[model samples]
Target: MNHALKTYQTWLNDSAVDEETKNELRGIADQPNEIEERFYKDLEFGTGGLRGVIGAGTNRMNRYSVARTTQGLADYLKKDGQDPAPSVVIAYDSRNQSPEFALEAALVCAGNGIKAYVFESLRPTPELSFFVRRLQASAGVVITASHNPPEYNGYKVYDGTGCQLVPELAEKVTARIREISSFGQVHKLEQTEAEQKKLLVWLGSNRDQEYIRAVASVSPRSEQMKSLAPQLKIIYTPLHGSGNRPVRDALDALGFTQVSVVSEQEHPDPGFSTVASPNPEEKDAFAMAIRMAEKEGADLIIGTDPDCDRMGAVVRGPDGKFEVLTGNQSGALMIHYLLSSLKETGALPDNGAVVKTIVTSEMGAAIADRYGVQTLNTLTGFKYIGELMTRFERDGSFRFLFGYEESYGYLAGNYARDKDAVLASALICEAAAYYKGQGKSLYDVLQELYRDYGYFKEALISRTFKGKDGVDKIHSIMEDWRSRPPHDVDGTRVVRALDYLEGIEGLRRENVMKFVLEDGSWFCLRPSGTEPKIKIYLAVRKTSNKEADQALKQISEAILTRID
Candidate 1:
């Protein structure tokens, strides 16, 4: 029998496995394919930690897997030992089984004699990042799959600095995870026992106000907002996740009295019944919000993902139709708004700088250059950005003004190390209200930006591969392109190529490739760390929006034809 088959048989015989799981396994006994899919391998504890379909198997996300991963983390924390008893902070989003998994993780920590500070109910992922340092805990864990579908759930670890564990730190945890032999070896404690021992502590609404206050403090145009907010109509949607309360309270605190919530998506529904995917980046996620905006004649619309870390915006364009702004467009608008506002007040720091990923658009950088502010580029992942922010605070080499990526994720103030939709929501609305007071819309300002900086266009494409065979195909695709790279497509010359697998440009080694064209257009290819998908990013600049859009389409098709 295969290894997967043997693992299935062992689960059937093991008394430690739960009765419900055993029954589920028995249902699949007649189907070898289902057995192989469920037991192919332990759900990988990658750099971002574990995420998988919620089910019963070594390769699935269940109570056993959650506890097993938590054991490794507990062992790692206890290895060096602490002068004081070590503690951990835990938070979860409004996903199915999120609350249960969170409690199980807390029990594992309690069983290991570590104190656990768990939120009383669901909260945004960034709040966990904030309280990790606020509570002075040893580490943090948040249960969420972010914007993924309802059937999926995840576990991500954060270091003491309130930043997600980067590659180096994550590898140590992964090594320890592989040492545990079986579910029976992991530890657990009863809730009453944990509470009696004072190992489990519950957090409540007072902390929510502190987080909301911190986010509201990032509003740069609060003075103008107080006077103009009542006149500016805004629409927001949480998409059936955790953003409903805090996002509303942040806006309410900022004096935005004219705000309206999309009633259909304002509450927590674990099924996410209203939207096909809970991601705010997709236009379909804004369907209900748009109707509300149109009826209310709102000036702007904003939505955040289930975890409330990523934000998406929609505004009226020159043609008077509602248009969804791409990540690059929204990011560029924010950069210009922030720097210009600072310049107007003469508070723009001389050593101020912004950080973006390698795949983000250049328009933001171009705007920063005009104001004498510097911009730094990092490899993909907000964790890199967060890690850089921590370094800046430690050394004070440069003032960290902002950090963002082209995935609708942005962070403004240093109060939190992760991308925060609550903070971004406040800033974006303030930007709109600030400009609206000046007798111009956000779309009008975007047009002015295009006139000053050349028109820039960007596009992103993702191809997913599933199951065991899909993994082999992805590896083959990466090796093929690495060995034989493209030089020219339809007479376009490739001026330079940056292969990051060799640790290019003071960055760590990563399996990513970028080809820069002679006309300043470029495209990048990289495999995602959290999901089984490869992403392609493309960008170009031209004299006009039409020309830039055409070139981007042509180049994207030429590249896709070769890969697909």
Candidate 2:
């Protein structure tokens, strides 16, 4: 009759509970710490949807948690009424249990009399956004963890306008999720029953074609590509995720004849057999692609993440060695090539603008400004950039020419509200070809950019903290830093601080804090929303590459000391 055992008994007796779930719950009933961690609180729904480890606990991501979230969403939609229920689109990536989770969500929506369009198989996250807008669906859900590890999965919600729910709307969804007392109270219909009731609709190749056509139209250099396409030797890898077919189709349509796909990674693999992590932002993820590039003697190498929202590239340097470009360098090259080509062809818009996150390197801003284009900085997520694009399209302020984040996400057109690595793969190869025609390498352009913009180097350091205790430790670390802010770093005086959680400019109240030193070095600290880690970002501007590297090392050691 103890509290924990009683809760378990209630779950076992509930008609909605399955034998498998009951068995799993039985194993944790006697573990006090596990029970406390699982049932102490509910998973939070923030600006992004729910993301956590996949397990049988309430705090973890599971069918029950997904059902409750969908029911909450259904309730919210019911309140914002029309004669018929609102429509929703669901998509999944190649992750363990992703398809099951997507189907579970679709069933819940169908049970609530909502029209649900579920993809036949795994697809990229950005395509879900595009499908929502193209189908004019009221909302969308993508089951993915972006670049998180295999054990983790996530659910992201998007509005009718194809952007992630903003803060105010997310708060409402959170409130509704909180109102649900237990997972057994959430209702669901069998797939067959839902389909027979005309509530579930399966989408296949027709939608894929529509998305591909939209991606093709975003090409600003199609005509130039026709002339140089055959000569471009490019390599592409999806990293065993979802980008394989779409990226290949986009390139072949642009008349690129010599494009090669990394054979070992072309098929979707939930285990991501070829790399340690499927994230394109990490150099280790490109090991397979690099080997393939060397074998093919390719001029450039490109890889997309598991969800295909981010992209990374490697190019042959002037010294005949291949080097992976940082996110900032890749983004700068894309903007430089896209704008320069359009301006040359008299296609550049008079009010062109580029959007980037505040933590992203300023090299992009410098490049855009050189071309008479404005660069706007937003908060850390692509949703903010998408929101900005929607606003610009609503009011005639400026045309959204391009938008990117330093984590390898980039977008050139408004067809997709999220970053489309499939589109990026096509454009990146075209840019490489355009530069190759001028007898220059992408590396050459990057060096020139650094020479002109000063040697600006940036690095990201992430520290992982897991389990319930880790959360408290992370909080304590941040609180201690707030109490005794670093006045100096690496023998340099801190000149200014920007805290974003406070929403202030100089002394903002945000969870994020940025410190600028006397030598123009800067560092920032923030907790990651989608993962169990704290990230520190450092940037230093110096006159030479060696000096910048030295400054970066010093600053990194200083930050580590403070953390320790």
For each candidate in the order shown, give its overall lDDT on alpha carbons.
0.88, 0.84
lDDT of 1 by residue, 417-532 (tens): 88888888888888898889889888999989998999999999998988888788778888887898888865689898889999998889998999999899999988877788
lDDT by residue (46-143, candidate 2, tens digit) is 43578888887667888888898998887777775342659999999998899999999999999888989999999988899999998888889999
CA-RMSD of model 1? 1.4
In model 2, pairs of residues that clash are: 500-510, 501-509, 501-510, 501-511, 502-509, 502-510
TM, every model: 0.98, 0.95
Task: Give the lDDT of residue 289 in candidate 2.
Answer: 77
TM-score for candidate 2: 0.95
Residues forming the 10-long window of minimal summed lDDT in candidate 1: 76-85
Off by over 4 Å in 2: 1-10, 46-48, 81-84, 505-509
